[model samples]
Target chain A: MENPYLPYPVRIDEIITETEDKNLKTYKLVFLNTDDEEKFIFQAGQFAELSIAGQGEIPIGIASSPSEKGFLKFTVNKVGRVTTHLHNMTVGDIMGVRGPLGNYYPWDRMEGKNVVIIGGGFAFTTLRSSIIYMLHPKNRSRFKDIHVIYGARTPGMLLYRDELTEWEKRDDIYMHITVDATDDPDWKYHIGFVPTITDQKAPEGNADTYAIVCGPPIMIKFTQPVLDKLKYSHENIIMSLEMRMKCGIGICGRCNIGTEYVCKDGPVFTLDQLNRMPKEY
Target chain B: MNVIKIDKKTWTEGIGRLQGFYRLIGPVKDGDFYQFKALEKGESPDFSMLNTRLSPKSIIYPQSEVMFEYSLDETRDDCHVIKEIQVEYSPQVVFGIRPCDAKAFLLVQRNFETPEYKDPYWIRLYETTALIGLACNTPCSTCFCVDAGSGPFNDAGLDILLIDAGEYYYARVNTAKGEKILKDSGWSEETETKDAELAIENLKQAAENRITARISTDRLKEKGVPDLFNAPFWEDVAFACINCGTCTYVCPTCWCFDIQDEVRGTDGVRMRNWDSCMYPLFTLHGSGHNPRDAKTKRLRQRFMHKLKYYVDKYNDGIQCVGCGRCINLCPVNIDIRKICEAMNGFEPEQKSI
Candidate 1:
């Protein structure tokens, strides 16, 4: 059997700082071996374990769409050792990546249905991938109206600013950006928390509508009720959770909440599924 | 199945003959307790003890095992490439093992050898090992293996089961490996006496009957996850736990691990070490959030995973084999039997302040 622990080598082709504090950076990586690239097919909302060989490995959500061929993108926040080491690296520096792990959003099931995406702070990476995938020319006609409600603590903390600007001009999707509170003169978006903005701007929930939400624990805890009040069934409100993981193959045993191994069973779950699991995560 | 008898005087000679063909491992005196270790030449297992302090899981899944080795020397053509270290998988015998400990390996195998992924290191080691279990003639005060899907003479995972018959040993061979070892050892004296088999069965029943302890697992699966998560008794259960990680390390079924890369100048080895859920660092996220940060949460996780979650997931009784190593080794005297009964009997409708 192939060793799941061994990571394939990749090199950074481009790096984009997404936040003012320079805490978050989006790296565009190209696999050193073309065979690895061909084998690493992934869907939106799935994650991969990025490693620095000596430093360690950490799970990061894949931030680019599967439709975008050739390169893979990961938006990493400089929170711990591995990310700090990765942030210090420049283009051409080698790193290791293993996966396309965990279950992804149910995109195939949402075909011809209205899509509602709620994102908060740096947690928007996977949602960004989903948006890009749903908006792609080949996939656009399969989905109906797309509504995006995204927010950050401040205007400067928002990620993918250029893409947000481009998305705001697109006629195919509706985009609403916000900040908790901002005084920047260039700020042209609403100023409030995600749940409040979601309550006011999100489309009325229906049987044909599917909602995907990702954020910090507090944001998710509060957003669930807002989605509930909007009449979204527990089965339709999807969420992506964050947990400390190792092996990403489900053997190390840290990401278990009840009997579910988040690395293998999910980083994504429906509200109905979450209701059945222990609240450890 | 085959039954053979070996006189007490010839047991050492039989072991000596087997050692010539395979490496021998068994329990031996270690300070104040017994431990499973590789037997040197002329050494015999000390079968006087009820059980070993630490489990024999390390034989198959070592506490720290190297998975890959790589060199950083740029001049070498294979530099920076990780090569799997060649491991010796010669046939070996784990003699004088407790039946419960042997059964624990089968439970752990469910995690390591799944259809989607198999741990080559663990699988390879397990495949080459033949377990020779010593039936418990004297049940310990803490032993509850009878309640955990195993018993004094359970032959679920053992290749051979040896019962002490005072003046001699009655060995029951359960597999081809066991028969081969017995035949090679030249101890294959067939016992045609029906009284010997009757005596072994009587002794097994008496030993099992001596174990008066039991834990209720009847209601564990019926309880809701949230009710158990929010149970008010967690603080009481977690109060005495110091998070020493002794229980996990000594457990026969606990299989959590942490992987790290070790570098010594030009060479690097990626290794995995045994990790415990009792530690705060086990679930610490890179983003400064820990889901099981509090001691109560960590303590709750351990029990819930073993008694409730494992039962629900595998539909196999529980993750615990009930060897009672944790009960014996715990500094605070935290008993799993009590916790299991508490969880199994927990009523969500009754609120406790």
Candidate 2:
């Protein structure tokens, strides 16, 4: 039997400071063993425990799409001890990545449906992965129309700026980028909160359209009403929950919401499912 | 099943002979209280005590266990690489364990050995240790095992169930492991199968009838999850909880843990220690958000997990064996029996105009 607590060794290949504040940095890691790399099959919206020796481990979402190969990417915010230690490390530093833990977004249900990706602030990591995954040439035909409404506190705080620009030029997918309030006169994007932009630009929700929302609690709380007003059924709205987790495989028992272990049963649950559970998270 | 009639005089000799084959862990007297500890040379288990202060869960899952060890020194060939620690999973015999504590293992097993993922650490240790249960002829006043899906003489998780009948022990071997241990211990005095079976049944019935305290769990499965979660009686039920985590520590089914890395210079070991839901840090998010922030919320979670959540998830009995260690140890006298009664009888109030 595989030891669920054990982590696979990975060496840091590159590190990119994503936002201007330098709180967020994306690490590109390569598995030390070829066999280990082959074993790590993952999907968008799933997270992994990044193990830093002598420090600890933190659960971070996998920011890289499965279609993108040879390396795994994790966009970490330098908030706690393990992340702080991660920020000070240099390239080629060896650490460990424990999983492709937690369930992914409902891809089986989303297939052949129009996907509306709504994201805000630093939570755009997995959304970026989803956007890249859907835009892949092989996967592009799996879905119909794709719309993305991404927002941030400021223009500098937006993640994957270069990729956003490239995506904006593509006619295959729609990109509506916004900021809370930016004073920069050179900024060309819309100025509004994510919910406002989502209300203005997202496609009319129906049985055929699914909106996957990932953001801070405030953003999610406000955006839900907008999606509901837009005729989105409870089941059509997908969300990813945040919780303090250890043993990402769910045995450690801290990340539970009701009987469901967020690390195993979810991190991704629909609004319909959330309504049945305690509003604890 | 192998039935043996061993005189009380030979019991110590049998245990001593078996100690050479397996590590002996049993309840030993410890200054007005009994504790489960490894038997040193010439030591034997004291069966006079009702039960140990703490559950024998530590024998399978320790209070703190090292998962891996590593070195931070770059001079070494394997610097920064975490390696799995060498754990000695030697065969062990937990002798004289109460039947209620033995049954607690079965409840905890569902969490560790699920269909999708099996916990390697828990499964390995549990598989190696054979439980030798001493049927509780006289249960404690706080014990409510009868209604909590376990009985004083429950043999759900035991390899052997030993019943003291006057001068000899009626050994009921329930598994091959039990028979092997009994045979290897040089205890081969056979008893008539009919006589042994009848005596065990009578002892089991009398012992069960001695338990007067009872808690209702029949209605627990029928209660809705959200209705029970938002019940109004939680305030009174959780009023005296000081969040000391004593209830969770003494609970055999409370298998929650927290993992951390401890460092001494260049050497580091990643270990997991028993964690409780009552602690504020248990659910505090990194971004300064706490879902279960209040004392009432934390207290509610512990009961909800054990009573409502476990019932909803497994559809089995609650995640408890009615060991009553928590009841005996709680400084505030926070009783699970009362909380279970409230939950079992909970009904949402009708809104008035």
Candidate 3:
């Protein structure tokens, strides 16, 4: 229910660089206004627009969990003009961050349900929010089962390497990762695209099960069919969307398909809501 | 029933008196067409005329406007908010608006000042703008305002109504704001009958004769099932459409808008600009999926919305002023009236008047 249009100035205390994938990275930032932290918290599955003076702006997901308040973290990819400069930044660089914008996975509705997490390539940035929220100790019993099927192109391209290892150590969550082709001799998770792994896993799906997936457009297209075979109803399957978002709010027409505004009605939606949307996305 | 008449010479004085109290505005003859221009010391808007090239909504909701400016300081976290103070709007009088445009302007109020989504920019402009609906002395062939529930002398969405009878004119106050302006303008008095009726009847016949085309919409609700969504009858109507958004742009009630946020350094202002559904890019997703991709499907969406969908939702027909701007502006001459006629083709002989 937060206003997508209002953006508070968040100070970037520092920026962290993760992954040598050349196209993507993550930044850990701390809000300068301590008071705003209490009021300015954002949910996982929500995103913020990061901007630099004269350099341009881009949408980056809050890779850091909402529960971890004071500091803000963004897992971003250097796709276009703004993102390219974003990757070249130092720790003290000032950038504008607006939002916890768009709808997040409603955990209240998602509780007591089998939760499936799907991530592909840099699109995994959006899922990092949900992944952390599910892994949080306080919210563990709300979900029946937590499963993550994440994939990337190669070893160096994989994001959140340290966190991925730590999360995998926990017995409560199931983490399965795959890569298109891995050169690392030590690597032994899986060796195919995400969609292939999804098809092979064929997780059980019922009315109570929820599937959340994000990644490259191709991965999303392929994985949808796999989830369908699992008996996951469209209403129970959730996904995040990406577009060339300018105003991280619904006011900008660029991120809309018909009456649906990606920044307002959702960046996260059940497949049921997605069905009502014009097939443009 | 007061019948007061004045010469065309007194028109300038009347308008000048309006200029003394308000930011007086009305339609002025812009070559062959008319446009809403501010009334200076002595400017009486032409009453008997064609519609304006641009809508009066431009006055409130401009084509493009800078919302606010932002400045980024590399050292600071909070953005430097550059407050934009627009020029003060004088209490204004919008004179000589056609009945169709009046209705269109009235419809715009919801998007601007609705309880849930009140736009301060649109509201500020609307607060100072007053409308004076002018009767079309020689109504155009394409005018179906009456069918749309507004007409040559329609006063549904006006603060004041004016009807032209040859050399002189008749005026009726519709709102308290309009009544106040009338007192300030020192108009003789509003008449009870005859002059307004004579002008209305003359224009009505002129409107009907010019609009030789007809379509039955009462059958639309009965037959516009999902199966009829892609009927073959669509091709004939869509064949002439250019997809330039002229229909939507000139339309009095089309209210789709696009939001834009521009951040230069650390500072930025978000803006909401007008948008149309006709554009293919509007519905295309980042995943490269498009539902209403087909031109035929989009074309159907446009007419169906006018005749069926919006009606179902609002309990009112999607507003079309029937000003015929869509007809005249369409590149291939894809007339809306023609489309309605084609819709009737879905189940022709069965419907009766």
How far in Å is the alpha carbon of A5 misplaced in model 2?
1.0
Pairs clashing within candidate 1: none
What is the lDDT, from 0 to 100, of the residue B65 in candidate 1?
96
Question: Which scores greater on lDDT, model 2 or model 3?
Answer: 2
| Poorly placed runs, candidate 2 (over 4 Å) | B350-353
True contacts kept of each: 0.59, 0.84, 0.12
Candidate 1 - CAPRI tier? medium
For model 3, the stretches where C-alpha displacement exceeds 4 angstroms are A1-6, A28-42, A48-62, A88-90, A244-259, A276-278, B1-10, B71-87, B112-116, B166-168, B188-245, B256-315, B340-353
- Comparing 1 and 2 on lDDT, the stronger one: 2
User: Could you give the CAPRI-style class of model 3?
Assistant: incorrect
Per-model TM-score, in order, reads: 0.96, 0.99, 0.83
lDDT for each residue of candidate 2 in B254-328, tens digit (9 for 90 to 100): 999999999999999999999999999999999999999998999999999999999989998898889899999
Clashing pairs in 2: none
TM-score of 3: 0.83
Winning candidate number (lDDT): 2
Scored on chain A only, each candidate's TM-score is 0.98, 0.99, 0.93
User: In DockQ, how does model 2 score against the reference complex?
Assistant: 0.72
Scored by lDDT, model 1 comes in at 0.90
lDDT by residue for model 1 (A65-141), tens: 99999899999999887888889989977777889899999988899999999999999999999999999999999
Summarize candidate 2's per-residue lDDT along A45-118 as a digit string, tens digits. 99999999999999999999999999999999989899999999989999999998999999999999999999
